[model samples]
Target: MQCLYFDQDVTSGTLTIDDPELAGENLFDVSSQRKRYIRNHKYGMVYQNPVKGLRMDFSSISNIAEKQIAAGGRHVGNMQSAGERLLDVVSIPLFRMKEEPRNFSGGMQQRVQIAKALSNDPPILFLDEVTTGLDLSVQAAVIDLIKQIQRDLGISMIVVSHDLAVIRMLADRTLVMLNGRVIESGLTDQILEDPNHAYTQQLVYSLL
Candidate 1:
Protein backbone atom coordinates (compact mmCIF):
# COMPACT_ATOMS: atom_id res chain seq x y z
CA MET A 1 0.00 0.00 0.00
CA GLN A 2 1.14 3.54 -0.69
CA CYS A 3 1.33 5.25 2.69
CA LEU A 4 2.32 8.72 3.85
CA TYR A 5 5.13 8.57 6.39
CA PHE A 6 4.65 11.07 9.23
CA ASP A 7 7.04 11.95 12.05
CA GLN A 8 9.21 8.93 11.36
CA ASP A 9 12.97 8.72 11.16
CA VAL A 10 13.72 7.99 7.51
CA THR A 11 17.36 8.36 6.60
CA SER A 12 16.80 7.38 2.96
CA GLY A 13 13.43 6.74 1.35
CA THR A 14 11.45 8.24 -1.48
CA LEU A 15 7.80 9.03 -0.72
CA THR A 16 5.98 8.83 -4.05
CA ILE A 17 2.52 10.18 -4.75
CA ASP A 18 -0.08 8.12 -6.60
CA ASP A 19 -2.65 10.89 -7.03
CA PRO A 20 -2.83 11.95 -10.68
CA GLU A 21 -2.42 15.62 -9.77
CA LEU A 22 1.07 14.91 -8.47
CA ALA A 23 1.71 11.37 -9.59
CA GLY A 24 5.30 10.07 -9.32
CA GLU A 25 6.33 13.17 -7.38
CA ASN A 26 8.37 12.51 -4.24
CA LEU A 27 6.46 13.96 -1.28
CA PHE A 28 9.66 13.95 0.79
CA ASP A 29 11.25 16.32 -1.71
CA VAL A 30 8.28 18.60 -2.39
CA SER A 31 8.75 22.36 -2.34
CA SER A 32 7.22 24.29 0.58
CA GLN A 33 4.61 25.81 -1.72
CA ARG A 34 3.67 22.37 -3.06
CA LYS A 35 3.43 21.03 0.48
CA ARG A 36 1.12 23.89 1.45
CA TYR A 37 -1.06 23.26 -1.58
CA ILE A 38 -1.28 19.57 -0.72
CA ARG A 39 -2.12 20.31 2.92
CA ASN A 40 -4.78 22.88 2.16
CA HIS A 41 -6.40 21.08 -0.72
CA LYS A 42 -5.88 17.35 -0.28
CA TYR A 43 -5.79 16.53 3.41
CA GLY A 44 -7.95 16.90 6.55
CA MET A 45 -6.69 16.09 10.03
CA VAL A 46 -8.32 15.43 13.43
CA TYR A 47 -5.90 15.50 16.33
CA GLN A 48 -6.03 13.33 19.50
CA ASN A 49 -6.83 16.46 21.46
CA PRO A 50 -9.80 18.54 20.34
CA VAL A 51 -7.85 21.62 21.41
CA LYS A 52 -5.25 20.91 18.79
CA GLY A 53 -7.86 20.61 16.03
CA LEU A 54 -10.32 23.34 17.13
CA ARG A 55 -10.30 26.91 18.24
CA MET A 56 -11.93 26.46 21.64
CA ASP A 57 -13.45 29.90 21.88
CA PHE A 58 -15.03 29.86 18.44
CA SER A 59 -18.60 28.69 17.94
CA SER A 60 -18.91 25.23 16.41
CA ILE A 61 -20.40 26.66 13.22
CA SER A 62 -17.73 29.36 13.03
CA ASN A 63 -15.00 26.76 13.48
CA ILE A 64 -16.35 24.73 10.62
CA ALA A 65 -16.88 27.82 8.46
CA GLU A 66 -13.32 29.01 9.15
CA LYS A 67 -11.97 25.80 7.68
CA GLN A 68 -14.17 26.24 4.63
CA ILE A 69 -12.95 29.79 4.22
CA ALA A 70 -9.35 28.64 4.49
CA ALA A 71 -10.04 26.18 1.69
CA GLY A 72 -11.20 29.11 -0.51
CA GLY A 73 -14.92 29.04 0.08
CA ARG A 74 -16.28 32.58 -0.36
CA HIS A 75 -20.05 32.49 -0.17
CA VAL A 76 -21.14 33.25 3.38
CA GLY A 77 -24.56 31.64 3.05
CA ASN A 78 -23.10 28.53 1.44
CA MET A 79 -20.43 28.18 4.14
CA GLN A 80 -23.07 28.46 6.87
CA SER A 81 -25.21 25.85 5.14
CA ALA A 82 -22.25 23.52 4.83
CA GLY A 83 -21.39 23.97 8.48
CA GLU A 84 -24.95 23.19 9.53
CA ARG A 85 -25.01 20.15 7.26
CA LEU A 86 -21.78 18.81 8.73
CA LEU A 87 -22.98 19.39 12.28
CA ASP A 88 -26.11 17.38 11.48
CA VAL A 89 -24.00 14.65 9.90
CA VAL A 90 -21.94 14.44 13.08
CA SER A 91 -25.15 14.32 15.21
CA ILE A 92 -24.62 17.64 16.92
CA PRO A 93 -27.89 19.39 17.54
CA LEU A 94 -28.49 22.46 15.32
CA PHE A 95 -29.67 24.51 18.26
CA ARG A 96 -26.20 24.26 19.80
CA MET A 97 -24.36 25.11 16.61
CA LYS A 98 -23.52 28.56 17.84
CA GLU A 99 -22.08 27.33 21.14
CA GLU A 100 -18.30 27.24 21.61
CA PRO A 101 -16.74 23.77 21.58
CA ARG A 102 -15.19 24.51 24.98
CA ASN A 103 -18.69 24.36 26.48
CA PHE A 104 -19.32 20.87 25.13
CA SER A 105 -18.48 17.43 26.46
CA GLY A 106 -15.47 15.52 25.25
CA GLY A 107 -17.49 13.54 22.73
CA MET A 108 -19.34 16.63 21.51
CA GLN A 109 -16.07 18.50 21.19
CA GLN A 110 -14.65 15.65 19.15
CA ARG A 111 -17.75 15.72 16.99
CA VAL A 112 -17.18 19.41 16.32
CA GLN A 113 -13.58 18.65 15.40
CA ILE A 114 -14.77 15.99 12.97
CA ALA A 115 -17.25 18.43 11.45
CA LYS A 116 -14.57 21.05 11.01
CA ALA A 117 -12.18 18.54 9.45
CA LEU A 118 -14.81 17.60 6.87
CA SER A 119 -15.61 21.22 6.08
CA ASN A 120 -13.42 21.25 3.00
CA ASP A 121 -14.31 17.72 1.91
CA PRO A 122 -10.72 16.60 1.51
CA PRO A 123 -10.08 13.23 -0.13
CA ILE A 124 -7.82 11.97 2.67
CA LEU A 125 -8.35 12.40 6.42
CA PHE A 126 -5.86 11.72 9.18
CA LEU A 127 -7.48 10.84 12.52
CA ASP A 128 -5.00 10.65 15.36
CA GLU A 129 -6.28 8.87 18.50
CA VAL A 130 -9.68 10.53 18.13
CA THR A 131 -11.38 8.55 20.87
CA THR A 132 -8.52 8.34 23.32
CA GLY A 133 -10.01 10.44 26.10
CA LEU A 134 -13.71 9.75 25.70
CA ASP A 135 -15.95 7.62 27.86
CA LEU A 136 -16.48 4.04 26.66
CA SER A 137 -20.00 4.70 25.39
CA VAL A 138 -18.90 7.95 23.78
CA GLN A 139 -15.98 6.18 22.17
CA ALA A 140 -18.36 3.63 20.70
CA ALA A 141 -20.60 6.40 19.41
CA VAL A 142 -17.67 8.27 17.87
CA ILE A 143 -16.43 5.08 16.26
CA ASP A 144 -19.89 4.45 14.85
CA LEU A 145 -20.01 8.00 13.54
CA ILE A 146 -16.68 7.52 11.78
CA LYS A 147 -17.90 4.27 10.20
CA GLN A 148 -21.07 5.93 9.00
CA ILE A 149 -19.17 8.90 7.57
CA GLN A 150 -16.79 6.59 5.73
CA ARG A 151 -19.71 4.64 4.31
CA ASP A 152 -21.61 7.73 3.23
CA LEU A 153 -18.72 9.86 1.97
CA GLY A 154 -16.27 7.20 0.75
CA ILE A 155 -13.36 9.31 1.95
CA SER A 156 -10.04 7.61 2.70
CA MET A 157 -9.10 7.74 6.38
CA ILE A 158 -5.86 7.04 8.17
CA VAL A 159 -6.87 6.24 11.75
CA VAL A 160 -4.20 5.94 14.41
CA SER A 161 -5.17 4.28 17.67
CA HIS A 162 -3.65 1.98 20.28
CA ASP A 163 -6.92 0.16 21.06
CA LEU A 164 -7.26 -3.14 19.23
CA ALA A 165 -11.04 -3.09 19.56
CA VAL A 166 -11.10 0.34 17.90
CA ILE A 167 -8.91 -1.04 15.13
CA ARG A 168 -11.19 -4.04 14.78
CA MET A 169 -14.12 -1.72 14.35
CA LEU A 170 -12.54 0.93 12.08
CA ALA A 171 -9.82 -0.65 9.94
CA ASP A 172 -9.94 -2.86 6.87
CA ARG A 173 -6.15 -3.23 6.84
CA THR A 174 -3.92 -3.12 9.89
CA LEU A 175 -0.32 -2.07 10.43
CA VAL A 176 1.27 -3.03 13.73
CA MET A 177 4.23 -0.85 14.59
CA LEU A 178 7.02 -1.45 17.06
CA ASN A 179 9.61 1.19 17.87
CA GLY A 180 8.63 3.25 14.83
CA ARG A 181 8.87 0.30 12.41
CA VAL A 182 5.92 -1.59 10.96
CA ILE A 183 6.36 -5.07 12.44
CA GLU A 184 3.22 -6.65 11.03
CA SER A 185 0.61 -5.61 8.50
CA GLY A 186 -2.28 -7.35 6.74
CA LEU A 187 -6.03 -7.68 6.70
CA THR A 188 -7.41 -6.62 10.10
CA ASP A 189 -9.21 -9.91 10.62
CA GLN A 190 -6.12 -11.88 9.71
CA ILE A 191 -3.95 -9.96 12.17
CA LEU A 192 -6.57 -10.39 14.92
CA GLU A 193 -6.94 -14.10 14.21
CA ASP A 194 -3.34 -15.04 13.50
CA PRO A 195 -0.79 -12.36 14.12
CA ASN A 196 2.64 -13.31 12.72
CA HIS A 197 4.90 -11.20 14.92
CA ALA A 198 5.48 -12.26 18.55
CA TYR A 199 4.40 -8.89 19.90
CA THR A 200 1.38 -8.90 17.65
CA GLN A 201 0.41 -12.38 18.84
CA GLN A 202 0.66 -11.26 22.44
CA LEU A 203 -1.44 -8.19 21.70
CA VAL A 204 -4.17 -10.27 20.07
CA TYR A 205 -4.14 -12.81 22.87
CA SER A 206 -4.42 -10.20 25.57
CA LEU A 207 -7.69 -8.96 24.13
CA LEU A 208 -9.29 -12.37 24.68
Candidate 2:
Protein backbone atom coordinates (compact mmCIF):
# COMPACT_ATOMS: atom_id res chain seq x y z
CA MET A 1 0.00 0.00 0.00
CA GLN A 2 2.95 2.31 0.59
CA CYS A 3 4.10 2.09 -3.02
CA LEU A 4 1.02 3.32 -4.82
CA TYR A 5 2.70 3.24 -8.22
CA PHE A 6 0.96 -0.06 -8.95
CA ASP A 7 -2.42 1.13 -7.68
CA GLN A 8 -4.67 2.82 -10.18
CA ASP A 9 -7.06 4.07 -7.50
CA VAL A 10 -4.43 5.83 -5.41
CA THR A 11 -4.57 9.60 -5.90
CA SER A 12 -2.69 11.36 -3.10
CA GLY A 13 0.59 10.88 -1.19
CA THR A 14 4.31 11.50 -1.24
CA LEU A 15 6.94 8.82 -1.68
CA THR A 16 10.29 10.20 -0.60
CA ILE A 17 13.92 9.23 -0.39
CA ASP A 18 15.77 11.46 2.14
CA ASP A 19 14.44 15.05 2.01
CA PRO A 20 13.11 15.63 -1.49
CA GLU A 21 9.57 14.21 -1.77
CA LEU A 22 8.62 12.03 -4.68
CA ALA A 23 5.16 12.95 -5.89
CA GLY A 24 2.91 9.94 -6.21
CA GLU A 25 3.07 9.77 -10.02
CA ASN A 26 -0.40 8.32 -9.67
CA LEU A 27 -1.39 11.75 -8.33
CA PHE A 28 1.17 14.39 -9.36
CA ASP A 29 3.76 13.40 -11.99
CA VAL A 30 7.25 11.99 -12.51
CA SER A 31 9.66 11.50 -15.37
CA SER A 32 9.65 8.01 -16.84
CA GLN A 33 13.45 7.82 -16.83
CA ARG A 34 13.63 8.73 -13.13
CA LYS A 35 10.88 6.25 -12.32
CA ARG A 36 12.79 3.55 -14.19
CA TYR A 37 15.96 4.36 -12.29
CA ILE A 38 14.15 4.24 -8.94
CA ARG A 39 12.52 0.91 -9.79
CA ASN A 40 15.70 -0.67 -11.15
CA HIS A 41 18.11 0.45 -8.45
CA LYS A 42 16.11 1.09 -5.28
CA TYR A 43 13.12 -1.21 -5.35
CA GLY A 44 12.82 -4.94 -5.96
CA MET A 45 9.37 -6.34 -6.72
CA VAL A 46 8.14 -9.95 -6.92
CA TYR A 47 4.73 -10.25 -8.47
CA GLN A 48 2.19 -12.95 -7.68
CA ASN A 49 2.53 -14.44 -11.15
CA PRO A 50 6.03 -15.65 -11.96
CA VAL A 51 5.51 -15.13 -15.67
CA LYS A 52 4.72 -11.47 -15.10
CA GLY A 53 7.99 -10.95 -13.19
CA LEU A 54 10.33 -13.43 -14.91
CA ARG A 55 11.56 -14.37 -18.35
CA MET A 56 10.01 -17.83 -18.61
CA ASP A 57 12.09 -18.89 -21.62
CA PHE A 58 15.42 -17.81 -20.13
CA SER A 59 17.59 -19.89 -17.85
CA SER A 60 16.98 -19.20 -14.13
CA ILE A 61 20.48 -17.84 -13.82
CA SER A 62 20.00 -15.64 -16.86
CA ASN A 63 16.85 -14.17 -15.40
CA ILE A 64 18.71 -13.25 -12.24
CA ALA A 65 21.78 -12.08 -14.12
CA GLU A 66 19.73 -9.63 -16.17
CA LYS A 67 19.28 -7.39 -13.12
CA GLN A 68 23.03 -7.25 -12.56
CA ILE A 69 23.54 -6.81 -16.28
CA ALA A 70 21.24 -3.80 -16.24
CA ALA A 71 23.14 -2.46 -13.28
CA GLY A 72 26.33 -2.42 -15.45
CA GLY A 73 27.75 -5.81 -14.64
CA ARG A 74 30.06 -6.98 -17.48
CA HIS A 75 32.00 -9.93 -16.12
CA VAL A 76 30.37 -13.25 -17.04
CA GLY A 77 31.97 -15.29 -14.27
CA ASN A 78 31.05 -12.82 -11.54
CA MET A 79 27.48 -12.55 -12.76
CA GLN A 80 27.17 -16.33 -12.91
CA SER A 81 28.59 -16.66 -9.42
CA ALA A 82 26.20 -14.06 -8.08
CA GLY A 83 23.31 -15.84 -9.78
CA GLU A 84 24.28 -19.19 -8.26
CA ARG A 85 24.76 -17.65 -4.84
CA LEU A 86 21.29 -16.06 -5.05
CA LEU A 87 19.80 -19.39 -6.09
CA ASP A 88 21.44 -20.98 -3.05
CA VAL A 89 20.18 -18.15 -0.87
CA VAL A 90 16.63 -18.81 -2.03
CA SER A 91 17.05 -22.57 -1.47
CA ILE A 92 17.00 -23.40 -5.17
CA PRO A 93 19.47 -26.06 -6.26
CA LEU A 94 22.58 -24.88 -8.16
CA PHE A 95 21.93 -27.37 -10.97
CA ARG A 96 18.69 -25.62 -11.87
CA MET A 97 20.60 -22.45 -12.69
CA LYS A 98 20.77 -23.46 -16.35
CA GLU A 99 17.14 -24.54 -16.55
CA GLU A 100 14.25 -22.38 -17.74
CA PRO A 101 11.75 -21.32 -15.10
CA ARG A 102 8.89 -22.40 -17.39
CA ASN A 103 9.80 -26.01 -16.59
CA PHE A 104 10.09 -25.63 -12.84
CA SER A 105 7.39 -26.37 -10.26
CA GLY A 106 5.34 -23.41 -9.01
CA GLY A 107 7.28 -23.30 -5.75
CA MET A 108 10.61 -23.46 -7.56
CA GLN A 109 9.50 -20.79 -10.01
CA GLN A 110 8.59 -18.53 -7.09
CA ARG A 111 12.04 -19.13 -5.62
CA VAL A 112 13.64 -18.18 -8.93
CA GLN A 113 11.53 -15.04 -9.04
CA ILE A 114 12.66 -14.20 -5.50
CA ALA A 115 16.30 -14.70 -6.51
CA LYS A 116 15.83 -12.40 -9.46
CA ALA A 117 14.24 -9.75 -7.25
CA LEU A 118 17.22 -9.93 -4.90
CA SER A 119 19.72 -9.87 -7.73
CA ASN A 120 20.16 -6.13 -7.47
CA ASP A 121 20.38 -6.39 -3.69
CA PRO A 122 17.79 -3.63 -3.36
CA PRO A 123 17.15 -2.25 0.10
CA ILE A 124 13.36 -2.60 -0.17
CA LEU A 125 11.48 -5.57 -1.59
CA PHE A 126 7.78 -5.53 -2.41
CA LEU A 127 6.12 -8.95 -2.61
CA ASP A 128 2.55 -8.94 -3.86
CA GLU A 129 0.66 -12.09 -2.96
CA VAL A 130 3.76 -14.23 -3.48
CA THR A 131 2.33 -17.50 -2.17
CA THR A 132 -1.09 -17.25 -3.76
CA GLY A 133 -1.32 -20.36 -5.97
CA LEU A 134 1.17 -22.81 -4.51
CA ASP A 135 0.32 -26.02 -2.65
CA LEU A 136 -0.05 -25.56 1.12
CA SER A 137 3.29 -27.25 1.81
CA VAL A 138 4.98 -25.21 -0.87
CA GLN A 139 3.42 -22.04 0.50
CA ALA A 140 4.79 -22.83 3.93
CA ALA A 141 8.24 -23.47 2.53
CA VAL A 142 8.27 -20.26 0.53
CA ILE A 143 7.16 -18.26 3.54
CA ASP A 144 9.89 -19.85 5.63
CA LEU A 145 12.49 -19.05 2.99
CA ILE A 146 11.35 -15.40 2.91
CA LYS A 147 11.64 -15.17 6.68
CA GLN A 148 15.16 -16.61 6.55
CA ILE A 149 16.21 -14.18 3.84
CA GLN A 150 14.92 -11.23 5.87
CA ARG A 151 16.84 -12.45 8.91
CA ASP A 152 20.09 -12.93 7.01
CA LEU A 153 19.98 -9.87 4.77
CA GLY A 154 17.97 -7.45 6.95
CA ILE A 155 16.17 -6.25 3.83
CA SER A 156 12.87 -4.50 4.54
CA MET A 157 9.84 -6.05 2.86
CA ILE A 158 6.29 -4.96 2.19
CA VAL A 159 4.17 -8.06 1.64
CA VAL A 160 0.62 -7.91 0.34
CA SER A 161 -1.45 -10.99 0.96
CA HIS A 162 -4.92 -11.96 2.13
CA ASP A 163 -3.58 -15.08 3.80
CA LEU A 164 -3.49 -14.64 7.56
CA ALA A 165 -1.03 -17.49 7.92
CA VAL A 166 1.54 -15.61 5.88
CA ILE A 167 1.05 -12.48 8.00
CA ARG A 168 1.50 -14.49 11.20
CA MET A 169 4.66 -16.10 9.91
CA LEU A 170 6.41 -13.06 8.43
CA ALA A 171 4.95 -9.79 9.64
CA ASP A 172 5.75 -8.05 12.88
CA ARG A 173 3.20 -5.24 12.43
CA THR A 174 -0.11 -5.82 10.66
CA LEU A 175 -2.70 -3.63 8.98
CA VAL A 176 -6.18 -4.78 8.09
CA MET A 177 -7.65 -2.94 5.16
CA LEU A 178 -11.23 -2.86 3.95
CA ASN A 179 -12.40 -1.08 0.82
CA GLY A 180 -8.99 0.58 0.38
CA ARG A 181 -8.93 2.00 3.90
CA VAL A 182 -7.16 0.58 6.91
CA ILE A 183 -9.65 -0.60 9.55
CA GLU A 184 -7.09 -1.85 12.04
CA SER A 185 -3.35 -1.55 12.57
CA GLY A 186 -1.30 -3.04 15.35
CA LEU A 187 1.19 -5.77 16.26
CA THR A 188 0.50 -8.92 14.24
CA ASP A 189 -0.38 -11.13 17.21
CA GLN A 190 -2.54 -8.48 18.82
CA ILE A 191 -4.42 -7.74 15.61
CA LEU A 192 -4.98 -11.44 14.97
CA GLU A 193 -6.16 -12.28 18.47
CA ASP A 194 -7.93 -9.15 19.65
CA PRO A 195 -9.04 -7.20 16.61
CA ASN A 196 -10.81 -3.99 17.61
CA HIS A 197 -12.56 -3.32 14.33
CA ALA A 198 -15.68 -5.35 13.55
CA TYR A 199 -14.43 -6.25 10.07
CA THR A 200 -11.05 -7.25 11.42
CA GLN A 201 -12.74 -9.48 14.02
CA GLN A 202 -14.71 -11.16 11.26
CA LEU A 203 -11.55 -11.67 9.23
CA VAL A 204 -9.84 -13.26 12.20
CA TYR A 205 -12.82 -15.51 12.95
CA SER A 206 -13.20 -16.62 9.34
CA LEU A 207 -9.61 -17.77 9.33
CA LEU A 208 -10.21 -19.75 12.51
Candidate 3:
Protein backbone atom coordinates (compact mmCIF):
# COMPACT_ATOMS: atom_id res chain seq x y z
CA MET A 1 0.00 0.00 0.00
CA GLN A 2 1.15 3.52 -0.77
CA CYS A 3 1.22 5.71 2.28
CA LEU A 4 0.44 9.43 2.24
CA TYR A 5 1.76 11.71 4.92
CA PHE A 6 0.55 15.08 6.09
CA ASP A 7 2.73 17.34 8.19
CA GLN A 8 1.33 20.48 9.71
CA ASP A 9 3.35 23.26 11.27
CA VAL A 10 1.22 24.48 14.12
CA THR A 11 3.20 27.68 14.55
CA SER A 12 2.84 28.71 10.91
CA GLY A 13 -0.49 27.03 10.23
CA THR A 14 0.98 25.47 7.09
CA LEU A 15 0.11 21.94 5.96
CA THR A 16 2.15 19.92 3.53
CA ILE A 17 1.11 16.67 1.86
CA ASP A 18 3.90 14.25 0.97
CA ASP A 19 1.98 12.12 -1.50
CA PRO A 20 3.10 12.19 -5.14
CA GLU A 21 0.19 10.14 -6.43
CA LEU A 22 -2.45 12.18 -4.64
CA ALA A 23 -1.12 15.50 -5.89
CA GLY A 24 0.70 14.42 -9.07
CA GLU A 25 3.36 16.75 -7.68
CA ASN A 26 4.05 18.84 -4.60
CA LEU A 27 0.88 20.81 -3.92
CA PHE A 28 2.76 23.64 -2.29
CA ASP A 29 4.94 24.01 -5.34
CA VAL A 30 2.00 25.54 -7.13
CA SER A 31 1.75 29.31 -7.33
CA SER A 32 -0.17 30.95 -4.52
CA GLN A 33 -2.69 32.38 -7.00
CA ARG A 34 -3.31 28.93 -8.51
CA LYS A 35 -3.72 27.42 -5.05
CA ARG A 36 -6.24 30.08 -4.18
CA TYR A 37 -8.16 29.39 -7.38
CA ILE A 38 -8.26 25.66 -6.67
CA ARG A 39 -9.34 26.26 -3.07
CA ASN A 40 -12.09 28.65 -4.07
CA HIS A 41 -13.42 26.87 -7.13
CA LYS A 42 -12.69 23.15 -6.77
CA TYR A 43 -12.84 22.18 -3.12
CA GLY A 44 -15.29 22.48 -0.23
CA MET A 45 -14.34 21.95 3.40
CA VAL A 46 -16.46 21.46 6.54
CA TYR A 47 -14.42 22.14 9.66
CA GLN A 48 -14.90 20.25 12.92
CA ASN A 49 -16.05 23.43 14.57
CA PRO A 50 -18.97 25.17 12.98
CA VAL A 51 -17.49 28.48 14.13
CA LYS A 52 -14.47 27.88 11.95
CA GLY A 53 -16.60 27.18 8.90
CA LEU A 54 -19.39 29.69 9.56
CA ARG A 55 -19.92 33.30 10.41
CA MET A 56 -21.99 32.76 13.52
CA ASP A 57 -23.68 36.09 13.25
CA PHE A 58 -24.66 35.81 9.61
CA SER A 59 -28.10 34.51 8.77
CA SER A 60 -28.06 30.94 7.44
CA ILE A 61 -29.14 32.20 4.04
CA SER A 62 -26.33 34.73 4.00
CA ASN A 63 -23.88 32.06 5.02
CA ILE A 64 -24.82 29.95 2.03
CA ALA A 65 -24.92 32.98 -0.23
CA GLU A 66 -21.45 34.00 0.89
CA LYS A 67 -19.96 30.87 -0.59
CA GLN A 68 -21.96 31.25 -3.77
CA ILE A 69 -20.85 34.84 -4.04
CA ALA A 70 -17.24 33.87 -3.46
CA ALA A 71 -17.58 31.46 -6.35
CA GLY A 72 -18.60 34.38 -8.60
CA GLY A 73 -22.34 34.37 -8.21
CA ARG A 74 -23.60 37.94 -8.80
CA HIS A 75 -27.32 37.86 -9.40
CA VAL A 76 -29.18 38.47 -6.16
CA GLY A 77 -32.23 36.47 -7.22
CA ASN A 78 -30.17 33.48 -8.32
CA MET A 79 -28.08 33.46 -5.16
CA GLN A 80 -31.18 33.72 -3.01
CA SER A 81 -32.84 30.87 -4.88
CA ALA A 82 -29.73 28.69 -4.61
CA GLY A 83 -29.30 29.48 -0.92
CA GLU A 84 -32.92 28.61 -0.21
CA ARG A 85 -32.62 25.39 -2.21
CA LEU A 86 -29.45 24.37 -0.36
CA LEU A 87 -31.05 25.15 3.01
CA ASP A 88 -33.94 22.89 2.05
CA VAL A 89 -31.54 20.20 0.88
CA VAL A 90 -29.84 20.18 4.28
CA SER A 91 -33.27 19.80 5.97
CA ILE A 92 -33.37 23.29 7.49
CA PRO A 93 -36.88 24.67 7.56
CA LEU A 94 -37.43 27.43 5.02
CA PHE A 95 -38.96 29.52 7.76
CA ARG A 96 -35.69 29.43 9.70
CA MET A 97 -33.47 30.23 6.73
CA LYS A 98 -32.95 33.77 7.96
CA GLU A 99 -32.01 32.80 11.51
CA GLU A 100 -28.39 33.12 12.66
CA PRO A 101 -26.68 29.77 13.17
CA ARG A 102 -25.60 30.87 16.66
CA ASN A 103 -29.23 30.68 17.74
CA PHE A 104 -29.64 27.12 16.46
CA SER A 105 -28.67 23.85 18.09
CA GLY A 106 -25.34 22.12 17.52
CA GLY A 107 -26.87 19.83 14.90
CA MET A 108 -28.46 22.74 13.12
CA GLN A 109 -25.18 24.67 13.04
CA GLN A 110 -23.45 21.70 11.43
CA ARG A 111 -26.26 21.41 8.94
CA VAL A 112 -25.81 25.07 8.02
CA GLN A 113 -22.11 24.47 7.66
CA ILE A 114 -22.85 21.59 5.31
CA ALA A 115 -25.21 23.78 3.33
CA LYS A 116 -22.59 26.48 2.98
CA ALA A 117 -19.98 23.97 1.85
CA LEU A 118 -22.27 22.67 -0.87
CA SER A 119 -23.08 26.16 -2.08
CA ASN A 120 -20.06 26.24 -4.37
CA ASP A 121 -21.04 22.91 -5.97
CA PRO A 122 -17.48 21.67 -5.73
CA PRO A 123 -16.65 18.18 -6.94
CA ILE A 124 -14.71 17.31 -3.80
CA LEU A 125 -15.78 17.86 -0.20
CA PHE A 126 -13.53 17.46 2.84
CA LEU A 127 -15.14 16.86 6.24
CA ASP A 128 -12.95 17.12 9.36
CA GLU A 129 -14.28 15.54 12.56
CA VAL A 130 -17.68 16.88 11.64
CA THR A 131 -19.61 15.06 14.35
CA THR A 132 -17.45 15.93 17.29
CA GLY A 133 -19.22 17.67 20.22
CA LEU A 134 -22.66 16.51 19.13
CA ASP A 135 -24.88 14.06 21.01
CA LEU A 136 -25.07 10.46 19.77
CA SER A 137 -28.50 10.93 18.20
CA VAL A 138 -27.33 14.14 16.54
CA GLN A 139 -24.23 12.41 15.25
CA ALA A 140 -26.34 9.65 13.75
CA ALA A 141 -28.61 12.19 12.12
CA VAL A 142 -25.64 14.04 10.63
CA ILE A 143 -24.14 10.80 9.35
CA ASP A 144 -27.45 9.89 7.72
CA LEU A 145 -27.62 13.31 6.15
CA ILE A 146 -24.10 12.90 4.77
CA LYS A 147 -25.00 9.53 3.25
CA GLN A 148 -28.13 10.96 1.68
CA ILE A 149 -26.15 13.90 0.28
CA GLN A 150 -23.58 11.56 -1.24
CA ARG A 151 -26.35 9.60 -2.94
CA ASP A 152 -28.12 12.66 -4.28
CA LEU A 153 -25.10 14.73 -5.31
CA GLY A 154 -22.78 11.93 -6.43
CA ILE A 155 -19.78 14.02 -5.38
CA SER A 156 -16.53 12.71 -3.97
CA MET A 157 -16.04 13.15 -0.22
CA ILE A 158 -13.04 12.76 2.08
CA VAL A 159 -14.23 12.34 5.66
CA VAL A 160 -11.83 12.52 8.61
CA SER A 161 -12.98 11.19 11.95
CA HIS A 162 -11.70 9.17 14.90
CA ASP A 163 -15.00 7.39 15.43
CA LEU A 164 -14.90 3.79 14.19
CA ALA A 165 -18.68 3.67 13.91
CA VAL A 166 -18.62 6.78 11.76
CA ILE A 167 -15.98 5.21 9.55
CA ARG A 168 -18.01 2.02 9.20
CA MET A 169 -21.04 4.06 8.23
CA LEU A 170 -19.42 6.40 5.69
CA ALA A 171 -16.38 4.75 4.18
CA ASP A 172 -16.01 2.08 1.53
CA ARG A 173 -12.20 2.13 1.71
CA THR A 174 -10.50 2.44 5.08
CA LEU A 175 -7.06 3.70 6.04
CA VAL A 176 -5.92 2.88 9.54
CA MET A 177 -3.52 5.35 11.01
CA LEU A 178 -1.26 5.17 14.06
CA ASN A 179 0.85 8.07 15.30
CA GLY A 180 0.22 9.89 12.00
CA ARG A 181 1.26 6.93 9.90
CA VAL A 182 -1.08 4.88 7.74
CA ILE A 183 -0.50 1.40 9.14
CA GLU A 184 -3.04 -0.42 7.03
CA SER A 185 -5.61 0.24 4.33
CA GLY A 186 -8.12 -1.71 2.26
CA LEU A 187 -11.80 -2.29 1.78
CA THR A 188 -13.57 -1.31 5.00
CA ASP A 189 -15.25 -4.67 5.53
CA GLN A 190 -12.07 -6.61 4.72
CA ILE A 191 -10.08 -4.66 7.26
CA LEU A 192 -12.82 -4.92 9.88
CA GLU A 193 -13.20 -8.66 9.38
CA ASP A 194 -9.54 -9.57 9.02
CA PRO A 195 -7.25 -6.88 10.34
CA ASN A 196 -3.61 -7.76 9.66
CA HIS A 197 -1.77 -5.26 11.81
CA ALA A 198 -1.90 -5.77 15.59
CA TYR A 199 -3.18 -2.27 16.17
CA THR A 200 -5.83 -2.70 13.51
CA GLN A 201 -6.90 -5.96 15.10
CA GLN A 202 -7.21 -4.28 18.46
CA LEU A 203 -9.33 -1.56 16.93
CA VAL A 204 -11.59 -4.01 15.17
CA TYR A 205 -11.95 -6.15 18.30
CA SER A 206 -12.73 -3.11 20.36
CA LEU A 207 -15.51 -2.23 17.96
CA LEU A 208 -17.04 -5.63 18.67
Query: Global lDDT of each model?
Result: 0.87, 0.83, 0.82
lDDT of 2 by residue, 81-173 (tens): 999999998888897789999999999999999999898888878888999999999998999899998999998888899988899888889
Model 1, residue 107: C-alpha shift (Å):
0.2
Q: Model 1 Cα displacement at 70 (Å)?
A: 1.6
lDDT of 2: 0.83
Worst 10 residues of 1 by lDDT: 1-10
lDDT of 1: 0.87
Candidate ranking (lDDT, best to worst): 1, 2, 3
TM-score on alpha carbons, each prediction: 0.93, 0.89, 0.87
Question: Residue 52: error of model 1 in Å?
Answer: 0.4
> Best to worst by TM-score, what's the order?
1, 2, 3
Q: Extract clashing residue pairs from model 3.
A: none
**How good is model 2 by TM-score?**
0.89
Off by over 4 Å in 2: 1-10, 17-28
By TM-score, is 1 or 2 better?
1
Q: What's the lDDT of the predicted structure labeled candidate 3? A: 0.82
Off by over 4 Å in 1: 1-12
